[model samples]
Target chain A: MIELTINNIKVKAEEGMTILEAAKTVGISVPTLCHLKDLNPTGACRICVVEVEGFKNLIPSCAYPVSEGMVVDTNSNRVRRSRKTIVELLVENHPQDCLICVRNKNCELQDLSERYSVREHRFAGESKNHAIDISSASLERDPAKCILCGRCVRICNEVQKVGAIDFVNRGFSSIVTTPYNKGLNVSDCILCGQCIIVCPTAALREKSSLKIVTNTLASKTKYAVVQIAPAVRASLGEEYNMPAGTDVTGKLVSGLRRLGFKKVFDTNFAADLTIMEEATELIHRVQKNENLPLFTSCCPGWVKYAEGKHPEILDNISTCKSPHEMEGAVLKSYYARKMGLKPEDIFVVSIMPCTVKKYESARSELSKDSIPDVDAVITTRELVRLFNMAGVDFTDLPDDEFDNPLGESTGAAAIFGTSGGVMEAALRSAVFLITGKNSDNIEYTEIRGNRDIKESTLKIGDLELNVAVVNGIGNVETMIKKINSGEKKYHFIEVMACPGGCINGGGQPIHQKTENVIKRVKALYEIDRLATSRRSHENEAVKTIYKEYFEEPGSHLAHEILHTEYFDRSR
Target chain B: MNTNVLEKFPQNDRSALIPLLQEIQENYGYLPEEVLQQAADHVGMPLCTVYGVATFYNQFRLIPLGENVIRVCRGTACHVKSSANILFALETALNIKAGQTTRDKLFSLEVVSCIGACSIAPVISVNDEYFGRLAVKDIDKIVKKYSARKVSVSTANENQES
Candidate 1:
């Protein structure tokens, strides 16, 4: 440890630690914009400039290391003036349309300007007039409002490993965009939207589907049926004043009902259905020894990535539609028939904690008879905004139950919000189907956690099952290489696009600190533990639906409605 | 796109990016989108990163250059002497803004940092020929002269073809 004087107070900081990290340890937070934890600091924003004794220039604390016996003044008059000047310059080039911006109160730049008390710009100069890019169905890009912080670029390139956008040009002409300034639709963007969460301003955001939902709710001819995803109940409370990971499932149902939805359903029912189809498919593959490691097809982001980057493995993926997609299909077909309404009259809107689901809903392959399975997808953030717009006090609402039949789910479906939840849920049902009894252990702790890639072998009766669970698409290259080399063998694999799975999905409420993601992950686990039924096959609604409608899993009717095929999109 | 051209460079190494882009730009007058994608594939870099590097330097162009290029210096000396007014006048007369080519492809305008001609106060260079001590009134005459030269060159080519 090295001793230093910070603001006239003597403090000991660890060796090789940056000044910003050391200051935080002493309960002092030096503001930063481009300093993302666990990633290399770019220090391009220069907002964390601090004064040090014997140094002529103010050093960026985020990148500068602490020296022995150094004296640092983080809030000196000189530092204050310099910081204020930087804000002034940034504001001069930035647009003053904060009142109408998407991230009005939540923007980091707006927060910084308010804290620094920046009223007017001192040096007003030429500002770039770049147009917005709204070609992609999942996301929107506005270069005019960008502050050039490079956080979005860093997250998209390094964290997601999908460099669909980057800093183009230099100096005043620099803007973050796709190659040749083309539309993002033509680019290799998987529409995962990880960039939207890390952006400091309204430069990047998920496309708003709120207006369409509101219009559909007011229409007399249409009946707006809504379904909420499993991850949303774990993280949507963060948008309100509630703490992160607070389970607001009951309150969420009440709030959606207040918003004038005809019926409120749970996507977990469809998740249970997915587990039934996927596990049965896995067993069939194992018996035939055709496609050994059957990949999960629940995440739209991972599905699209596989379609684009590795089309050769398209056959290895399960044919089951995602939970929300399956829910929309069931709602339009069975629910519509029961209610005596046409599929066109029933507008299915899904409240998801994912941005890629919006794009997935628009896919022509997921549609039947030229009508989409799901009409619209609103993120958790959008749902929060809708509740606020409708004057619904989300936290104060009374606990209510989801509508019957489609709303009921099992504990295994609730855990699907986390990383290894799918693999665990599948094993619970696969073991029961293969043998005629339940396993001694239910948790299957081997494939659980936030690990990049987890591999395990378990003996279920006479067969030794090999399985792997992967989170974060950035960590998939090595596993793909290993699989291609035939060096590793596995019977099942679960992949989620976002790190930590749907609980930390791209469309969750934006939190500067990443700890909320961990909290959300734990919340889903708690929900799973408290439930009565712990397996997909045990879901009463699922068994009833199979007995009444499809007869069994992977049946002809199930294949037509619950299952789908893949396309060769590797261009 | 001539993707076969990328096989000449070493694959999967980011260090080969600059040289690969330079060769592409040399082969084609400006960097084409398809060619840049090919180069990105060769270097194992993202297309966005390749585009960012290509756009960072003013030496690289994304579109083909016009027949006659006009560069207006906006250095400190020229800016203080009202180079902004001169640039605006040129844009008005040509009906095109800076960093854009005219519809007929006869002329293009660009804003440059400095040509080391600060002694002249305001300088506008056209096709390597420098025009010093420029004024707002001089834009029309310069554009007319270039327009007349282009017409003459086209007529000369027509005569030779016939």
Candidate 2:
């Protein structure tokens, strides 16, 4: 540990810690824009500039390393002027439509402008007039609103490892785009929406399906059914001023119920079903020698990426549709039959921590009874808007459970929100199926963290099954490259496009720190461990669905409703 | 590089033109398609369109290239500084155009999109060992080094055969 004085306060910090980090440790607030923890600090935005005793110029505290006996002034006149200048310059070309912007209240730029009292820009330069690109099914990119902090580029390339977008052109005319300025829809973009989540401005946003959802809710002729994802429980509270990781599951269900939906369900129920199908499929594949090294198909972003970039490996991907999409299909088919209603009369809505599900729901192949599986898809943030629209006090609502058989889920289902949750859930069922016995060991702690890449092996019956989990696309690239080169071997692989799984998904309430993301992820795991049923097969609702409707696991009817196909996409 | 030659070439043929151009460039060090008419006959296209595609994109080579490919990144970030100097050095060294190869087939130069290392500006990757923070003075030393290494390898192979 090294001792230092920050803003006249003496502090002890770890050696090699940046002055900004030290300041943060001592509760000395320093403003920053382009500084995200666990990500490379580029010092592109000079807002965090602070005066050190020895340095002539105000140095960026974010990138400047703290030395022994360092004296720092966080809010001196020089520091203030520099910080204000940076904020003013950022606001100069920035779109002044803060009132109507999607990120109006939640914008960091807006907060900084208010903090620095930057009412008007002195150097209002000519703003770049570029058209918004909304061609992608999952995201919209407005180059005009881009501050060029390159957060999206860093998230997409450095964090996710999907180099789909790069700084194209030069200087004032420069823009972030894929090769040849091709539309993101046409490029090799896996619709993860991490870029949108990290973006400080409204330059990047999820493709809004709010209109479709609102239309369905407003329609009297059709009955709309909604399912909230597990990770959503830990995050939905953030939109309502509740702290991050607050399990607002019951309140979320109640809010959805108040929105006039015919039935409020949990995707955890389908996530339970996914485990059953996926685990059974994995065992079957191990026995059959047909597409060894089965890949989990839960993340739509990973699935699209596999289809677009690695079409040769399509056979390796599990045929199972994501839990949300599976629930939609099941609702349209089984639930519609039970209600004695036509599939068209029922509108299935899925609230997910993903933007790719927007694209997944609209796929031509996902339709079962001549109607699309999921009629509409909305993010957790969009759900907050719906709650507000209904005039429901999210905090005041009594905790309520989801309705009936479709609402039943296990702890395993709940954990599926986090990064390694899917792999761990699969292991629970896979171990049982292989041994034909319920083992006391349920938690596969090997794959249970927020690491970008995690690997483990478990002994089941006579075979030692090797498994690996990858959270981000960039990590997926390294794993895939190794797999392609025959450098690493694994029987089963779980790839979640968003880091820390669906719990920290792009559509989840945006929290900036890895520690906060891990906290939310841990809350998900804790919820899972404390729940009664820890395995998907143990869920009575899932068991009932299989026994009453589908007859058995991997049955023809089950396959038809729960599974889908993949297509090779051009790069 | 000549628009008139490309205009005279047929537009419909794609497959035959690529290989034909490759062969022509291999033999004469440039796509002298006037020496080879079989590609036009095989593809059932007039000669003009074939040359048009070859000259249209930066990927294709209508003229003879140097033996080594010296790709300088003219990407937005790289172009900001020192890149012009690097380009000027290459032009002076080879006495050839940006797209053209040396008469001795010693070097070929072209520009590319970003190489994904923005932190290290003014970079050039030769067969992908990105050299960053380059200076104009470093160009001659680097070029001479590659040339010397190539000569030594060829000599070693000759001695091994003997």
Candidate 3:
């Protein structure tokens, strides 16, 4: 322990803790832009600079280590002046059109400027007029608005291990962008959008599909259908100032109706469908001993990562498309046929807690004859914005149930929002199908949590099933190596690109507290626990779809729509 | 993108990024995308990260340089003495934008952060020959002199030995 006097308050700080962390214990918060928690501090932004009693220069509290008997003045007049000056310089180089920006109310830089009372720029100079990269299906990168905080670079490169963007060039010309600034579409970007979440300003944002959705809904010729992902319902309420873990599923269904959408479908129905198809595929593979471990292809980010980086294991991945994609395909095909509407006339929009879904929806492989499965994908944040634009009060909205045929789902489908939720959901149904009896245990707590990688061997009936759950795409390489090297054996493997699965997805609301995200993860489990049907096979809608249309899971018709192929994009 | 340069480094080592990039830049004059990908493959680093390091230093270039690279300084001293006009004149004379190569690959104009010759305000160095106290009127003559002469591509350090 190190004794330090922070702002004249005598306090004891943990040894090796940064001055910023130490100061926080004493009710002092040093503002930081580039200092991401748990990641290595770049100290690129000097906003967190603090004055030491003896030192002449203000030290970056985020990077500087706490020393014994150190006297720190976090909010001294000199420190305030320096911090204010830094904000002024940043603003001088930054765009002043914050009123019209996407992150107008929820920006870290804007908050810092407000706290420091920075109204005018003192040293206005030449700002870089780099072109915005809108080529990416997922995100738009506006270099003009970037403050060069390197938060996006750190999160994408360090945390996600994608390294899609970085601090390119030097000094004034420094901008976070993909290789050679040749646009993100052609680059090795997985389009996971982890960078968009970490970005402090409106420099990075989702390529909005709200305009297309609104136009499609208003069109007389177009029969617009909307579907919401499992994770979205848990996180969407956060955008409306509601507490996290608050199940806005009822309100969300009601809000979509208010947005002039008559047909509102839950992606959870398709999640149950995914479980059926995936479990069947896994069983077939296990029985034949061909592709012993079936990798989950539910996350397009993970699928793209495998395609681009590990093409050798492409065959190991399940052919099933993600839940929303399956829903879109069903909406265009079966739903369209039932309603006597052409696939072209019906526009399917998916509300997802992911930006990668935007990329996935636009995939050529998922499309047949140039018509994509899902037409447009709007993020949870974008949905909140849509509701706001339509003058819909989310809080006062009456609870409404999802539309029938594609609305009803099982509790297992609801749990598909979390990290090991897919593996658990699949196992719950797989065990029942294999044994022809209900197992007392439904929850596979062994494979749960936000661990980078989790592995477990569970006794299901007579077979001991070895399964691995990769919570994030970044933690996949080690497990992939284990599988490839024959060092480890597994019957099933589930991977989601974003940490903690879609519940903490990149397209979710910008959370000021991580507890909110944790609450979202728990809310999914709570939804799973307090449901009538807890298994995928028990979902009446899924059973009906299988009986009426697709014959059964893994049938020819099911494979045609539910399954997709992978390509070697290893550039 | 040549294989000979990449095979020299040990594979899967992140520490070899800087030296490997430096060697690649030295061998190929500029860091090509294909070669950068290969280098990243060799070091087990992402191509974007390799690109970031390569671009962080002005010493490295993504695009190939022309026959003669004209560097116009934009240091504090140079900027104060109307270096923007000097750069503009060079761009007009070369018929290319700053930080761009001429259509014929004869000249590549670049505005350097600094030339370190602050005493000689607003300086433009062509290859090795330093032209201090540069004026906008002298830009055409300088461009013509370089274009007319037989092209010789060399750095300022190699031939500018006093």
Candidate 4:
């Protein structure tokens, strides 16, 4: 431990802790923009400059280590002046379109400008005026708004291990861009959107589906059908200033209904539907001893990652489309049939807590006869904007249930929001399928939490199933290496591209604190705990859908509608 | 498509990325897009990252150098002597930026630090010939002289000299 005096308050800090972190311990919050938690510090932005007694220069507190008996002034005249100057310089170069910016209120740089009282521009710096990258269907990159903080670059290269973009050129000429500054569509970008979540400005965001969704909703000829993902309910409440982990599913349903949707369904019902087909597929793979390790194909980000970097494992991936895709296919097929509407007449909008779903919904494999299974995908963040645009008072909105049989789901479906959830959900029924009885133990505590990789073996009936859950795409290389070296073996694996699973997906609310992600994960489990039925096989709606349209799980009709194929996109 | 540049290097070694790129540049004179992708596959790194590293350094070029290459010295000595004007004069004469090649592939202009010729401040070298202590007015005549010469690759000139 080291004793330091920050702002005349004597504080004890652990060795190797930065002055910014030490100050944080004593409630002296030093604002920072480029310091990503648990990642290596670059000190790219010098906003957290502090006055150290012995130092002649105002040191960046986030990069400076706290020493014993070190005297520091975080908000001294010199420190405040330097920090304010930094904000002014950044703001001067930045575009003055905050009112129309996607990250106006939630932007870190904007908050800093407000905190430093930067009412007027002091420096007339030139804007880079970089062309915005709207090449990808999922993400948009407006480099004009970038502060050169390196958050998005770091997240893309280091955290996600997808070096789609990097710091190109040198010094004042430096810009974060893809190879040759080509469109992200032609680059190595998996479009997971982890960069969007870490970006401090409006530089990175999802491509707007708002205009299309709104136009489609107002269309009298085309029926606008919407589905809400399980994670959106777990995290969207934070947008309304509600406490994190608060389940706003009912209010979310109410808000969507008020948004003029003809019918609002739950993606969880499809999540349940997914489990039935996936579990059967896994059982068959296990029984046949072909494609021994069936990788879960629920995460489109991971699916795309596998398609690019590890195409060898593509066949091992389950052919089941993601839950929302399943819901769309079912809605377009059976639901449309029952409602006496043609597939072309139904415009499916999925409110997903994912950015890759936008790209996933456009996959040609998921479409039939040029009609996409899902028409437009709006993120959880965009849905908040949509509600605000429509003047829906979300807080005061009465709790309302989701529409019809498609909205009903099981407890297993609710847990699909967090890491290790899909595996656990699949196991609850896989055990029943193999043993003709439900497993008394529902929660596989060994594979839970935010660990990058969690693997466990369980005895189900006479078979010992080896399963693994991968939380983030960055940690996947370890699994890939182990599997290739024949050192580790598993019967099944569940992977979510973003850490902590869909609750912390790239399309969710812009939350920087890790606690908020934990809260979201816990909220999903709470929903599962309070649910009446805990197994996917027990979902009456799923059973009804199978009886009404598809004959059964893994049937010919189920394969045609619910399952899809992958392609080798390796560069 | 010849890849003898990587024959001696160990396969699947990411540490060899720079050495591999240097070898490719030595052979091809400029990094080709297809070869860089092959290098990425060999080194187990992403193609974009390889492109990033290739571009981060000033030594590597994605396109071939022109037949007439001009290097304007912007070192500590030359910069004080107003080499900026010389570079701007050259850009105007050549119709290209300092780091870009001409649209006709006849002239390429680049700024260099020093070429052991600081004795002559504000110096520029065009195709292995140096012009020292030159004013901005001298650029048009030098450009005309290079344009009248026969079309020859800069690599062929270097090869013949070596």
The most accurate candidate by lDDT is: 4
TM-scores for candidates 1 onward, in order = 0.94, 0.78, 0.93, 0.96
lDDT of 4 by residue, B63-112 (tens): 99988899999998998999999999888877789888988788888889
- Descending-DockQ candidate ranking: 1, 3, 4, 2
lDDT per residue for candidate 1 within A130-158, as digits (tens), equals 89899999999999988888888888889
lDDT of 3 at A249: 90
- Candidate 1's C-alpha runs over 4 A off are B1-5, B71-90, B110-146, B149-162
Candidate 1 overall lDDT versus native: 0.89
Residue B33 Cα positional deviation in candidate 4, in Å, after optimal superposition:
2.1
Q: Using TM-score as the measure, which candidate wins? A: 4
Mind giving the per-residue lDDT tens digits that candidate 4 earns over A1-571?
8998999999999999999899999899999988998988888799988999988998988898989899999989888888899999989888999988999899998999999999996887667779999999999988888888898887887878888888777766778888889999878888888899999999999998999999988888999989999999989989989999999999988888899998989999999999999999999999999996899999999999999878888999999999999999999999989989999999999998899999999999999899999999999999988999999999999999989889999899999989999999999999987888997898888999888899999898678898999989888998877777887668999989998898888899996899999998899999999999999999999999989889889999999999999999986
What lDDT score is found at residue A280 in candidate 4? 98
DockQ winner: 1
Candidate 1, which CAPRI tier? high
Better of 1 and 4 by TM-score: 4
lDDT of 1 by residue, B69-89 (tens): 999999999999999998999
* lDDT, residue A554, model 3: 94
lDDT for each residue of candidate 3 in A1-571, tens digit (9 for 90 to 100): 8898999999898889999999888788889988888888878789999999889888999999999999998888999999999888888888889889999989988898899998676896897788889998998989998988888887787778887887777877787888878888888788887787888898999999988999988899887888999999888877777888889999999999999886999999999999999999998998899987899999999999999888998999999999999998998888888888888887888999999999999889888678899999999899989999999999999999999899999999998889999999999999888988878899889888878998888787678889999988888887888887997678899999998899888898985567888999988999999999999999998888888899988999999999999999986
Off by over 4 Å in 4: B7-19, B41-44, B118-120, B151-162
For each candidate, what is chain B's TM-score? 0.84, 0.68, 0.81, 0.90
Which DockQ values do the candidates obtain, in the order shown? 0.84, 0.03, 0.69, 0.61
